[model samples]
Target: MEGRAFTHTRRALWETRTTFETAPYGSIAAAYFAMWLGLRGIKLSAVILHDLATALGAKAVARATQYFLQSLRPEVGSQPVHGWDSLIFLIIYSVIVFLPLWWLADLRWARGAVYRYRATTRTTKALHFCAEAYSRPPGKRTSQLRDLESGLRAAENAILRAHRYAGTFPRRSPRSAAVRAHAALVAGALRAESLKIDADPNATLPRLGAMLAVIGERCAEGRIGAMLSEEFLAEATPVSLTRTAIRESVHVIVVVTAAMVAAVGGSSALRALGVNDDLRPWLIAGCSVVAAIVVGGWHRVGRLLELMPGK
Candidate 1:
């Protein structure tokens, strides 16, 4: 009966640890809500919907390419193209249309709002666990010690993840540097506490707990994640509604206009080269594929700039 009880206790502790480790994902919804609330008063621009614009631009480019190809081979235009050829074109189009959006979304800053909130929540919770452990008597501290250790580890992971996006162009801010140093301190302290606990299961972590309390206090005071306050509001660039509308209108017009011009120029270039009518369709397809790749790469590069942390 004693052995079974020990097994159950260990299993419970393991489950708690697992919960702490996966806590960041659950924190995402809260973070998103915090971010939305922060930006609620401000009018968001279509810039946030850049992925949609890129998709529309890709479609326009594809349509223009197709129109030009058909014009080049009026004789063969009547013949049904092979299924394989259409499928290949579609694959190329999809890559051009979706790859950039995926790349942009994958970047760390794309989720900065959530990461910031998670980091703050983790740090605060770690401090709470530490305080609880510190106040408890040594004889009754095993569970609290385990929870404190788990919380500290979770906080460290969250802080490091937030640290990744806490930089501006070319360099990180002083606040970010401090946060990173704090994360390193947490790592060292957690390790020391873990070693002490391994030596004696009932060991107290007063020093580690005290240190983490200071860090959490700083976080609450706007050192890291700004405690999800007005700092989040500052993250969004303030642009007039008129300017935003004009910017979006210009973006749509430019993308579509560029697509049409490129198609016309490409068709004229192929004609000047005296390319055979029989081969023009394949050549146009190849060129469209190349253009799609270049455009996708360009979009990815543009989105990568978002990785730079906002002030």
Candidate 2:
């Protein structure tokens, strides 16, 4: 729809610099608005709402967490400088300190959010429409029903082929391959159900319609079920868990090392900024503990890693 467009929220360096420094609110507002508008149609609103809720929940947790962390730090240098000067420092400090923690929390929730979003997009509206056609009077729907039935068989064969090929990826990308296998199984079941329908003499629309409705419902559910396939979960679980564990351990180590070093240098650093550091121990411990907690929430953080591309 355009020759040159900037759909991405982040672009040029100057724009990013200005946005982050002067009004991060603009960035936040743009992101929120874009999410709503981008997903306004095509039936993904539920996914968006879920993500919003997850983010809100993460924010609430991050707020409490940051408050507790602040309490653990020295109050000596925290006295206000007053006016906009103080605000600038506070903004910088908040970005430097709390944002990363909140971002990690958000990343945790974004995993489920992405999976739900992708699953929601794979709808069965076309199948429902075909169901309606199949429900019509026999004389009127013969040709359409025949074509639809043939199409279903073709789709089933294609999906079965895909399922067979999935084994090749079981060791490489088991999660996605498992989804295909699950979807293929469900599709196969639906095909068998359709094949079971009696085309007896003078069969009524009521019987045909019921079977079609069943097919339609199954069509809708199969895709979502694939997204949550047990086999896929089973095959992918160990890999994801291992990666998540290693990542979390590294994060904890980094946090502990960084905090301890910072606490050591904190006195000089604070003095340079005309402040003091009396709660070095508290700061070091709090930072280490908070970082560990952020990584240790396996259910939240682990799934987030699983959702990542090429994970």
Best by lDDT: 1
Name the weakest run of 10 consecutive residues (lDDT summed) in model 1.
227-236
Candidate 2, residue 252: Cα displacement in angstroms equals 56
lDDT of 1 at 230: 32
In the range 134-187, model 2's lDDT, one tens digit per residue, is 567656766666655655544443333332322323445556655555555545
Q: TM-scores across all candidates? A: 0.31, 0.25
Top TM-score prediction, candidate number = 1
The alpha-carbon lDDT assigned to residue 278 of candidate 2 equals 37
lDDT (Cα) of model 1: 0.49
Model 1, range 1-311, lDDT digits (tens) per residue? 11223343233234335634334454545555655563352223222333454577754444434533443354746745442345444454454444433433344344433333455556657767877876777678777777776686666555444455333322455666555544554444445554665455434455555444444444433355432223223333322334434864565455445545556676788889998765665666556545544544434333333443321
